[model samples]
Target chain A: MSKNNSRKIKQSVFIILMLTPAIVGFFVFYIYVNFKSVVMAFSFEKGGETFYGLDNFIRFFKEFTLPDTMFKDTILNTLKSFLSTIVIVYPVSLIMCYFIYKKIVGYRFFRCLFYIPAIIMPTVSAVLFKYIISMEGPIDVFLMRFFGRNVPDFLQDGSLAMGTIIFYSVYFSFGGNILYFGGAMNGISQEVIESATLDGCGWVRELISIVIPMIWPTFSTLLLTASVGIFTASGPVLLFTQGGFNTYTISYWIYEQMLENNNLEFASAVGLSCSVIGFPIVMLIKWGLNKIGDKVGA
Target chain B: MKGSKIKRSISQRVVFAVVFVLFCIYAITLIYPYIFAFNAALKESGRVFTRDMVSLAKPARWKNFVDVFGEFVVSDSGYFKMTWNSVWYSFGGTMVKLITVTLSSYVVCKYRFKGRNLIYNTLIFTMVLPIVGSGPAMYKLLSDINFIESPMMIFTFAGGLMDLMLFAYFKSIPWEYAEAAFIDGAGHFKVFYKIMLPQAMPAISVIFIMTVVSCWNDYSAPILYMNEKYPTLASGLYSFHERIRYSHKHPIFFAGALFAILPPLAIFIAFQNSIMDKVFLGGLKG
Candidate 1:
């Protein structure tokens, strides 16, 4: 055989060799485990005899009920929490990137300072926020000194609890997003900015016309990935809210079923349902944005 | 108009400065709690509010770290064993991930093989599935199969498809070098090892550090599987905090958190230059 054919053969074998460890791992752990879970989800535990059917799933959906009280409050709170972060963080991150790209003084210092929270563990961040918002914590302590009024429990107050959690979530993670957006902004050529400047445009005009348009692709990338994740991003809630039966999102509810409640079938069903609902909504929105962005570009 | 340009430049600088300061102040607020945590850890159990503790002039209780290490028995027999366990787990995981991801990415990017998009799409699909979604079922399956407490648990924890990050990095590496290596009569392993892996080292290092930090800081796996007899530092930290919180005698629990966080923080600070280069430059320059 020629050297080229021999090389192809060697490459194929090597590829197989390289792929073995991950393949075995992915199959044995994730795929096999998930398969088992799927099978188990169909079976019910009864006196060590497993009865397999759709009964578990049927029971889950039929029996799952939301009290008017729960449906009324946590639903709104969850929506508010989710929307608030997107509304607040994305725009703020974009603006922050804008300044950094402008090469503002102390840009490096500001960038580093903002990103400090990103490296800290999420649980630690939540606990730190909890302390900060506590009655005796710095904010309240300062407020009490000025207003002579007792500061309420930020975590416990129904009206403010979700907002506060959302605020902390957004604030803590803003630094990382700034890095992402800044990187995207910096990817745009300096020549483009200079030419736009030469066209009798100032910072605001250049920003509005050029930078925003250029970075919209990155915005869509973020949207595609992160928007679907709002349902599943329950780590902070787990750490902070503890259960959020008071402010329970669907993901938290799913967690309770799987871990705390041990309704594996129900949990799987809920998990599946959340993916089903969230994925399409995210895809549609992303698709719509891309179309609009393309048309706007045109 | 020329005068206006001067004023505009001045205002622009002023706006930049103002925004920069406000941003700094905002970040300081985020970090203030950690600073307070540091201060709280420094105070002796009951002497938290003493007159001497009121001022920064009062030296921080550096003994807090000493007390934490004492609790860890970190000086005693086999203290470094657990650290080794964590390192091995992360290393093993990274090796597996690096191998799988590099090959899979090579196939998807370099070759037009069958089932290519299928594999790529499946990998992307896994990104949407939360580990928590499968956690309960996985725990049950592992328990039933007698896999809990086994060293194999490390593999389970690391089996998520991280091909996206790997693939993104691989795509940036021009195909020309690999082709040249192939032309030089190098086998695939030789090419991957000598050429691809070396080129991907910057990203590999970043991702490796990320994995190690994750494994080292992880409390859940050890807490769930290893039982009390085989506690990782995080589990130990949790238990220690429980003891302190319940006893109302803070045994420098803040110091414990500090110790828990310090290794990763130090690693992060040491790599700060590389991190900026890799994170932004990799994305942009690619």
Candidate 2:
């Protein structure tokens, strides 16, 4: 074992040579880039960036302390959509996943149909959604008859835009999540399912008790990733609102800062703070889910 | 008891029927858009402008589809250039991802180097640590380094999700194959390319399809990084949308979208078996 270990160390030069590209990439992309973000977050760069001792952070917190600022709206918007993802989107998709897994009536056709959109460019789906939901589009025409005149532009109205975005997101959420949970359920031995059935377990009971517990890793993984969506998900906000009409997200804030505003220092500050705050929350959610899984599995 | 069993079955049938109907409605919502978009893409501008929605085909004017591809893509260049760009992006991006991921994961799996766990853990750690801040920093780095047009940014380290799965995949390969090659005086490169890389083909294929589809569809990256000199299919389509959005000609818009969707859609439909093999095997770990 010691001889093998020494030889492995001797091959360390070869290993280093093999790993050069990725290592350099990791340093340049991950380390150096993140280091700059953190540095810029601390420093105020509008008038020649210098370390200003948390002034940028202070400015962000003070400004976003306002109930209606862009920063506040972005954070709020991210939360609303992310919450919907957790509460509404995931559960609905999980149910869809369950049905698909069970091969419930035209599953293959339905699976292909749903999953195809995910593989297709989001640009395509975004265009399609925009086509239908635009002012005086099909939905508008249908609703125009109901209200008889002046139906709300679903993607334009401040009150309705987030809902529209969420709806579109949930509409496509069926694609990957189904394949995933289906794959997980497929991993479960048929003998287990058959024995459960023979023991007088119905589909619902068996799923809740046997299948879900078995697929805990997959379930928790999806849940945890979705939890992190609070910081990351910017779905159709870019298309729908362009960070306007009370639809800014943290991600959109970062984007708007870069493209529209060119205030990278402030964007860095906000972005850094979001991740710093978000990291613990994400970890908590993951830990809590794992704990629950342990209890349920037990 | 017999009556109870029958009642139970009757209720089950009703439940099944309800679920089926619900799922059918859901499936229609998912699929009907493509059908609508296809027919709309074949319509005349005059028909599209009509307020009345009609399912009846009014002698399908196929010119809209052709015009969308030929006439008004981003700038004077048409669909062909953008198609080439899309091909470059996906092909280049997938190649880069495979090389970077396969190499890095290979090292971690095969080597007993110090900091292997640290590198692996850090990569996993960084996945959840939102890199929104890094966008502008990266933009600065790219623009300053003059690699915005180079597609070198796409070649950077990745596999935030795939890292562990791929590591496991590489580790699962019998080390004897590599050892045999090494004993025959095969260098690391020879052994990796010849023995190990081919062995990791299933996982690599999953990563390939994912990266290609994503790179093909990804609009934001090129729009952010590259100028009109290197417009990808996705970014080109987006730019065209900006130009033609107010034209109120639904057919052309639908045609452009359909054009953009076709490649990735065709790829998915064609290679679904392999895609399913990965998804079923990997279980959407990403």
Please write out the lDDT profile of model 2 over residues B155-220, one tens digit for every residue: 642423226667877877889998988889887778888899998888787777777888888877
Alpha-carbon local distance difference test for all models: 0.65, 0.74
Candidate 1 on B56-91: residue-level lDDT in tens?
424567786676655543213122444455556556
How far out, in Å, is residue A26 in model 1? 2.9
Kindly report the interface RMSD of candidate 2, rounded to 1 decimal: 2.6
Q: What is the TM-score of chain A alone in each candidate?
A: 0.87, 0.91
User: How many pairs of residues collide in model 2?
Assistant: 1
The alpha-carbon lDDT assigned to residue A88 of candidate 1 equals 82
Candidate 1 per-residue lDDT, tens place, A1-298, comes to 6976976687677656655666677787789877766676667777878788877667655655534445345445556666766788788888887887776666777777676676665435565566667766666767777998756877787666666777777777778788778777877887798777777788988888888888777777676666767666633555556555366766666555544546776666555544556767777777788897896582
Residue A233 of model 2, lDDT score: 79
* Model 1 RMSD vs true structure: 4.2
lDDT of 2 at B278: 56
Number of clashes in every candidate structure? 0, 1
